[model samples]
Target: MTRLIVAAGGGGDAVAAAMLHAALYGDDERAVILTYAWDRLLVDPLPGPRGPHDFTGLEPLTRSVLSVPPQARPIPPADSTLPRLAAELPHTLALLDPHHGAQGITRQLEELVDHLTPRSVDLLDVGGDILAGGDEPTLKSPLADALTLAACAQTNTPVRLLIAGPGLDGEIPPDDLRPLLGPHIHTFTTADTTSIAAVLDWHPSEATAMLTATARGIRGTCEVRDAGLPVSLTDEGPTVHEVDLDNALDRNTLARSVMTTTTLTEAEAYSREICGFSEIDYERDKAARLKQQPPAKPDLASVLFRLDEFQAEARARGVTHTTLRRLSEVLRLGGSRRDELRSLMVSARPEQYVAPLWRIA
Candidate 1:
């Protein structure tokens, strides 16, 4: 029987969903992942999530639902990793278009269920942000996850909410999430990460990278994202916990508000009304600023000096490791120069440790 796995917040959640499928079913080709084309501002540069019109060569899974093929490409001005993910992952990767809002997404999901005839539907969230109470001070992105919750609430199939790597997103604190999480379902083993190892090399997902690192027995304080948010990596970082779908909807005030939204604009308005702000607004502003003044070329000496300064402060706070993505931001390097930065760092400091994460020292 096939299993329908929805990547709740998109981006790295899709990567985590692939890992979850492998861990639970083990080489089963019956897993289908439905995810959004929303990525970080550094990756996509676009303000909102890319829809069907933004891609080429998408195969229709249903009259309303479309599946991303390995050959699919995002139209110019719209960037996405879904096409590459489809090529790398073993299961079919279907696009989750949120432009039409919660009700529209519900219809698409219902159509997909009817077409696939899957035995189970699961919502996989890489970080526990899907459980946000909507007022959490650290919550940065919640609209997409809330939209997914609201859409899944209307689906006929019984949906299971699986939260992996609690607090790894640096949104909700681990202490705050302890009371809300349900029974632990599975703790990812090293073998579980085998399918995503190659994908992580090029994927810019900070949370999923931390999750995979934790599963590989790495434990320490990891600073991730452009914000340099410090997340504590522990044994809990590799485990998946199930939350009741109804309970999740109850906790997510924004999701409840957008349950009947007919357009993406309406849903975003509710997000701002309930959560004080919408992530798309932040992305739009950032993208505009980047367009006004593109990132400057990094001076090797200045970059190394800034890195040392940042490392000193991070170490003082007990931070032992950081992702290359975060390091790129720390060094004032643009997304395009990440590889160049890595090569420079490696050649300059051959003794420095490197993997999915680089040693901060």
Candidate 2:
């Protein structure tokens, strides 16, 4: 079961600070922590993976913070962990000027998709106020809606939304946000304080109740209970938000979050479904390369033979038997390998590949 926790807050409310805490400890337990930013400090570290091995699936997505930290560059595998590190988008769609770029925001949609190509995850925007572009009173604020919707449709994940502080305006009823979310949606909330003193007086249980009620009220078409875990509002604040999310959202949400930014083909999906197959491919490639050794010039014939060998190895490892229709897609492979892998897995039923020739005898 996957769980997705979307925490939203206004600037300096420490929304990511809250969500980051949840992400660090949530992954192995089948939980994902995500946040959206209007503006924030880039150098600040959220409570997340100390290292890659801490959790099975964990990452962060941001829309550019105050200052870019050395570790905050939007490049893989760094970008792989953090999706949507843009500075900002135009307030209104009409305001989108090719030359007048938004500050501290990820300006490119393709960049987000490419970054999240690996994990199967869900999308969560932390602060709705910023996402809605601050009630800028223009029809052009659809960038957030556009980005969120596109993220859901393209990645096949429903986005979890958060409404905080002034964001809960009259024009946009929280309930309306539900229908917009596809079947994969999951939602949560956390404490928001105007000052450190207010933060000190916050009650964990009471805050959690508010989050639970908010989730129920803002419920989307997707069955919240079926797709996610029960809400748990923690007083631990952003430091432990990820842990709280792990306990709240279920496996379905977690799976969605990892895939939210990922684009998969039938082949890659197949590889994921068939346990041990990917490991087999890795080992086979490793062994083949080792056999080739180094310094040896390859003839055309040898190269052709090597290609044939690779194909045969793939078949033996159950790659060729997949139901992926776009066989030519794999042949044209460059960066689309991820999608191809998913397609192959989702395309064919494993039963059809039972023949000995395709199997390792």
Candidate 3:
């Protein structure tokens, strides 16, 4: 029996979905992943999610649904890692277009279900942010997840909500997520990460990287994102937990509010109304500011100095590790300089953990 997994919230969730598939099905040819083309500011500076129109060479699954093939590329000015993920991941990577909003997403899901006729439909969220109450002060992005939840709730298919690496997104704390989570389904092992190990080297997904790292038995406090949010990596970090679809919808006010949204604009508006802000607005402002600044140059001494200072401070707060993405932010590096920064840091400290993470203590 095949499973249709929805990579809720996109970005790292797609990677997590691949890992989950590996853990559950083990190289199953019948599995399919439906995900959004939304990416981080570092990957896609344009802000927000990219739709079918933003890419070339997408294979149409239905009239409204498109699958991202290995050769598909995001048009210039809009960037993505979906094509790369398609190339690396074993399952078919289908695109989830939110341009038409929740109702449209529901239609697309129904079409996929009818077309594939999977035995089970699963919505996979990398972090537990899909359970957000919309009032969490740390909630940075809720629209995409909310749209996915609302859409899945409307689908005729009985969708299972699987949350891996609870609180890893740094949006909602794990302590805050305990009451919402259901039974622990599975814990990913080192073997489950084999398919995604090389991809993590260049992927800008801090949460999924952390999840896989924890699965590999790396522990302690790890920092992530621009804010350098510290997430405690515990044995539970790699465990997948299931939550009932209806119960999840009941807890997420943003999801309920956007249930009938017909356009991305409408859904984003509800996100702001319910969550007090939309992540896209932050992305738009950041993109505008990025356009004004010149590219950053790699400075090894400055990076080391900043890393020393940050590590001293982070150690005081009990943080032992941090993501390369967070390190790039701390050093004010972006674009190609981020890559250069990683190379310089790795050269300087060969013992540091691989590409996505560095051991500070």
The TM-scores, one per candidate, come to 0.95, 0.26, 0.96
Q: In model 2, what lDDT does residue 358 have? A: 16
Candidate 1 global TM-score: 0.95
RMSD of 2: 22.5
- Residue-level lDDT of model 2, residues 226-252, one tens digit each, is 111112212211111111122122212
| Quality of model 1 by C-alpha lDDT | 0.88
lDDT string for model 3 (1-361, tens) is: 5789999989689888888887887774557899988886777878899999999999988878899999999999898989988888888889999999899999999999999899788899988999998999989889999999999999997899999999888899898888888999999988888988988888888899999988998898998887778889988898899999899999999999999999999999998898889899999998898888755677778778888898899889888899988888777788545567777888888888553578876
Of models 1 and 2, which has the larger TM-score?
1
CA deviation > 4 Å runs, candidate 1: 298-302, 346-354
* Comparison by lDDT, 2 against 3, better one: 3
Candidate 3 similarity to native, TM-score = 0.96
Q: How badly does each model clash, as a count of residue pairs?
A: 0, 55, 0
lDDT (Cα, 0-100) at 317 in candidate 3: 88
Each candidate's lDDT (Cα)? 0.88, 0.26, 0.87
Which has the greatest lDDT? 1
